[model samples]
Target: MTDDTPAGRSPSRRTLLKAGLGAAALPFASPAVHAAARDVKISMQRSSVLFTVLKVKGTLAERLAPLGFTPTWHLFTSVIEPMNAGAVDIHADVADAVPIFTQSARAPLTFFARERGSPAAEAIIVPADSPIRTVGDLKGRTVGVSRGSGSHYVLAAALKRAGLSFDDIRPAYLQAPEGAAAFEQGSLDAWSIWDPFLAFAEAKRPVRAIANGTGLTSYHRYYLVNDSFVAAHPKVVATVYQALVEAGQWVKANPEAAVALLTPVWGDLPPAVVAAANARRTYQVEPVERAQLGEQQAIADTFLEAKLIPRRIDATDVRIWTPPAVKG
Candidate 1:
């Protein structure tokens, strides 16, 4: 699983062009012969604001068109299932902990890009009026969280920091909406989740954060591509990576504009809530480096100790694709 090439070194642009232009110069082909556009299926989730912006703006499709590729977008509640099923070519973004489970399942995915850690982005929150005022108070209380999510790791780390274990709390495995409903009904002691769900809940309800990933986890989100797709379409991968980089930059540079663009598609969440959620995120996309896998390894170990994932895995032992060098 180790790469012979130096870390951060990927196939060159020239090499990608050569690979993508296969049979274009066939001697027997007519002068008008052209390659049919291949479809690149991309998975999108509501929480991934950059991908949402790209989809709304048609940025990815426009970028891929010149490469003779057509972009096909698919929405998913959770992308890991489809990704493991090999149903998509690219996954827009997913929590840091997600890839670990995928890796344990031996999914053929390659990390291409990642947003920098935004520690405050995910948290464990309890009702503001609840007697549970701290992470330690949840020793025997019911906590809600999405299984195998970044917030799940946040809950685990927060519990461990408070000298508790996953067994200390009764976990209610639920999606964001379901967890929100349970929390509202006073059925759960605390709800562990990420923004804009976190932001939406805070704005809509009276909940106080007991602990976010601040001192525990980095909360880095990643972009991945199918390994088979990476091999057959290196140039397409590069294009998608660059587009994400640009999209990240755009989101950071124009916060108000970005929120305006995302409001409609984000389940019509309030602008203030969206902005608050975005403020907690760095939105700075960078190439995935092996050195950054330290937190990933920690996440894997945490999940393993909790018996969440199936088996142990070397988090760093995975494929990483570097984006092509930026042109002046």
Candidate 2:
């Protein structure tokens, strides 16, 4: 548990629990929770990662708690690790990973929720004063990204669109927070990262976005479940989606309050950055679209070219999707 300050400072989860619970301020109505009062056990990852914002707001649990469903918070450093090990039933992640996971497994993971038209939620960043003004300038410069994550895909796509190959740049493999710190320290030329880490770096350091999901692709965030989870309790899935859609709408409408609510989870990171990132993000619960499939196919092809994935895969074969009506 780290401290709750977002300035790359520590804000332990335990501290937030103490403070938020002490206030005893409940945020949701009972019907939201009671929908599954006795049938489901709902939980979420409790890390500072953006996908877990639902847990941070305490709204996800608040919505599900009174339903007789208690949310057990499982904290992990890497999201993929938990998803792979089956430690968590449902994983909220980016669409990029689906290409890799689908290529490797049978009956691939299915997405139930997507954030549509959320441009600039992810980006390649450098100091505002730095001379690297455009994507073309990124060539031959050091670009940092997590080896097997959404940021990695964004960097690949951005570089490809710039008519440059991965060979043209010095790639630094690092996690979001690590890469952000390196960029801020001037040790790295550019960092490819997702929010609120992206937001945090931009505010605390001299960083500016060279490019985001614009002109490249829509890097969507997804809520994925095992095919079995979808099979057994479809309504549970729909309920969660409905709650998330409501939460996302609330977030878009009340950025300041949302930031304050998330501060306990993000360690009090700067509110303006969070708000900016939120404003740029479209947190909608839409079904995965055909374009997304094409984009994911492109990602898999790129990863194959980069030798990141072991083999090429058909992006569509792994998907298990339901109609928009089935979701919130």
Candidate 3:
């Protein structure tokens, strides 16, 4: 009301209430009801070509821009520690068994996307000149591997297939780089590792593959998200998945370009090394199928039989992100 309409009397309660509400709705509104939306934090493994491309091409951020998502990429060599500490919202191109092992520690992770395993990429490598010819020869010898990795299971499975177990070999649990150095220094008799490392070593040195994943393990890689992130943001999960799937297809069609894109990000490794690594991988991303997770169950059982995981996990019983239907 104007000052002329109210000399010494205050405005009506209804008028005051309306004015208050309008003022509150104005541009200078109170700080948001919740914290400002933060950029989606994604964890990328150094050797994950699809994620490397995503970061290099800067397309994921553009795809998510309309929704106000700033994609923040964090480079990591492994995800367990980051997942445990909740450092990233999502992790892509992780070994299928890695998440299962994380589950044993009770990390709430959801399976979101998958890339079929290529056994050729994950192998047990020994020096070409080494006399250890068969899996059985691995008995009582020093084998370097990173604990809780896909190769961890591979070492155990290969030994088991040869009528042995982890106990049969002296396990040297070391990261790929460290293991590479050790293996080069003649400290390790053999190294069980996955692609990029497997690919790099083979190309740069005189290493021979004792065995690959074919009969032993599928070596499937998966995209995982912290349970809380997917629960709070389903659409965000879909966006990430679609981006990865497309990127995977691009990598499959353009292996050389994939390597070129990944080289700089991967510390300028040789183009041939990157291409070989990409060649050894099946970059075809697909939806997570519950019925087809028998291998996952197998991985869980393998870990359990070897006392790697604390308990048997169904592997298929975790939260899975179903992509939203495409709009017409």
- The sequence of per-residue lDDT tens digits that candidate 3 reaches over residues 1-328 is 0001111223454543332211111111111222344578877654567876776677777777667676766655556777767778887577767877777777878888888878887889999999999889999999998888888878888888899998888999876667767777789999888877776677667888888787987888888898898998887889889998899899988877777776655545678877888887888888887887888888899989998877878877877776765322
- Please give the lDDT score at residue 31 for candidate 1: 19
The parts of candidate 2 lying over 4 Å away from their true place are 1-7, 12-68, 95-99, 102-108, 289-292, 323-328
Task: Give lDDT for model 2.
Answer: 0.63
Task: Give the runs in model 3 whose Cα sits over 4 Å from its true position.
Answer: 1-37, 326-328
| Candidate 1 Cα errors over 4 Å, as ranges | 1-35, 326-328
* Local lDDT at 267 for model 1: 42
Quote the lDDT for 306 in model 3: 90
Tens digits of per-residue lDDT, candidate 2, 28-146, equal 12233444455342323222234355655555566555445645444433556445555555564454544465445453356666766555777898888899998899888999887
Best by lDDT: 1
lDDT of each: 0.78, 0.63, 0.73
Which candidate gets the maximum TM-score versus the true structure? 1
Give one digit per residue, the lDDT tens place, for model 1 in 171-245. Answer: 999876677777777889998988877887788778899999998888899999999999899899888878888
lDDT for 190 in candidate 1 is 94
